[model samples]
Target: MKRSSRKQLQNRRAIWMSIIVLTGMVWSLYKLSASLTLASASLPLTELAVSPGKNHAAPQNGTSRYKILIDPGHGGKDPGAAGASGKQEKAYTLALSKKVFDQLRQDPVFEVVMTRTDDTFVELEGRAQIANELDADAFISIHGNTYKDPDVSGTETFYYADDSFVLAQKVHEQLVKSTGFKDRGVKKEGWKVLRDSKHPAVFLEVGYLTNRNNETDMLSEAHQIRTAQAIANGIKNYFARF
Candidate 1:
């Protein structure tokens, strides 16, 4: 073969070899990039993401669980109203509030907290403060009513905020039905707890302790459980709006 032809042939071989080397490097880089991308996608998002803080976990549907604050009215030194049978309002409120809390706690949709679990004095303003600090979705205060006329017997609910009126109505409706008492209906009042709470708040005067019939029913365990169930149902119904 001619020397020039031989050199040209060698040049062609070198060019092809260089192209193959470049192609191989390009393919290897692409494979590395693709592997990195797949590994990144496989990593759990929660592991990479920062937490939003100490709030309740959301449901599978991406909705947050409702945070409910239950306040039992008039505790410790504050005995509230007196029953005909001498039952203190504190005792009645605590009992009923606990029942409500228990029912609510059973539902995974709700995260329930109580201002006072025992007969401890929690100031009216303090109760609201707790709810506000916790960023509770709702606040429910349980109480027994009293009047100059012992015959004034019924279930009444109070709310201070305009937004809370619906909550009051929902709870009061169930309360009246459960207690089988005359429905005094929902009323607006600037009670300390209702007024101070940042969230929707409802104050339940479950029954007039001054009335013999109301007192008897309010003090009964079965009646208390029924009332608690009603209150829990009302709260669940209200949360459904969200």
Candidate 2:
């Protein structure tokens, strides 16, 4: 080969190598930015608004038809599930439950009461006792699930004993419809809060945190609000029949 041609070939090889390095660097940076975005995006935007001084009397919208208690699972030291994007299941559950409360409050008939409005933790038994004290028509515990196999994703509802099956059915069906997640069906479990409650009660496992798809969806405010609205609507429908 000619000396000039050899020099030209070397120069071209160097240029191609530099292009490859630059492309790799850009790709790495893109991935890093995406990860950071996900991490920050998972943070909860809503904290408890109602304080001890706030009146517990259900907000008056119109007619007084029913009284319900909503229990947001885990809080304070109890981070229900460690999500892939560093989201805490406890925070998500609380946010969703609050949305449900707001939806129910819109209907003057529903006198909704939450077990805890803040980040404080309430014992499982204490949660049920509060509902009993209020003589709630029904009790609903809001929670998220987790699994070793990150692929497991779905909504499951559990009844304390048996009489609460109807409530579970109503809530679970609405959750599946709104979230578009697999319907794990109503189950029977002796969850502490459900077992000791005087009124009929059910516990909801919204979705598996270990699953990336579920984690992403649960982190979204829109999804949480929709889920809450669906549960509220289902409760209304269930009571309308009575």
Candidate 3:
């Protein structure tokens, strides 16, 4: 073969090799750029939060706290029910109501109010009136029960208006699980406090006071705390859906 012809062929081969190497480098760079773009697009929300306490925070542009009204069933001279342990329903109701109220007050998410904070007489009509006047988001009247059989020991939750059903169901479900008591199930009743309230309202009969075992359990400090926690959790769960 001639030298010039051989030299031309060698130069052409070298140029083709360089072109192949350059093309491979360009393709690798493109793939790396694509990977970086995808990583940036899918970054975690926590990493992007500009302020402290904003991580995983829900959008609360103009949300306001919910107002809750609690009514102790009976107070003052009106003892709605009597227990085997010689405790009046009024006393137990007031105590439990306060506990539940305190539990809910821990979070700034709720504005808590009680019909009767102490052993003071407040009529059924008056209770509903307070809730209406305050424009409460929800109302719950707490009570204890009594029966001749004394064997009937369980929790009872009642709702008067159609809007009250969801609150009753949620609170009752959580109470039943927390207390590990017989679930009497959610019921419907036209109690004055419930029926008259403009906002959603529910009545909770904690347990049959006539039952010695239930009466003792309800009076326990531990059970009261659990009961209060359960009610708070239920209320929170109810609001979470909305």
Q: How does model 2 fare in lDDT?
A: 0.83
List the candidate 2 regions with Cα displacement exceeding 4 Å: 1-63
Error of 3 at 178 (Å): 1.1
> Which model is ahead, 1 or 2, in terms of lDDT?
1
lDDT string for model 3 (1-242, tens) is 99999999999999999999999999999999999988887675545563333211132334567788888898987988889888899998888899999999998988899998888898778999999998778888888889999888999899998878888999999988987779899999987888899887889988889999899999999998899898888888766654
Best by TM-score: 3
lDDT of 1 by residue, 32-103 (tens): 999999889867665536443222222323555778899999998899998888789999999999999999
Steric clashes per prediction: 0, 0, 0
**Candidate 1 TM-score, true structure as reference:** 0.74
Give the Cα lDDT of each candidate: 0.88, 0.83, 0.85
Of models 1 and 3, which has the larger TM-score? 3
RMSD (Å) of each candidate, 1 decimal: 11.2, 21.5, 6.5
Alpha-carbon TM-score of each model against the true structure: 0.74, 0.73, 0.75
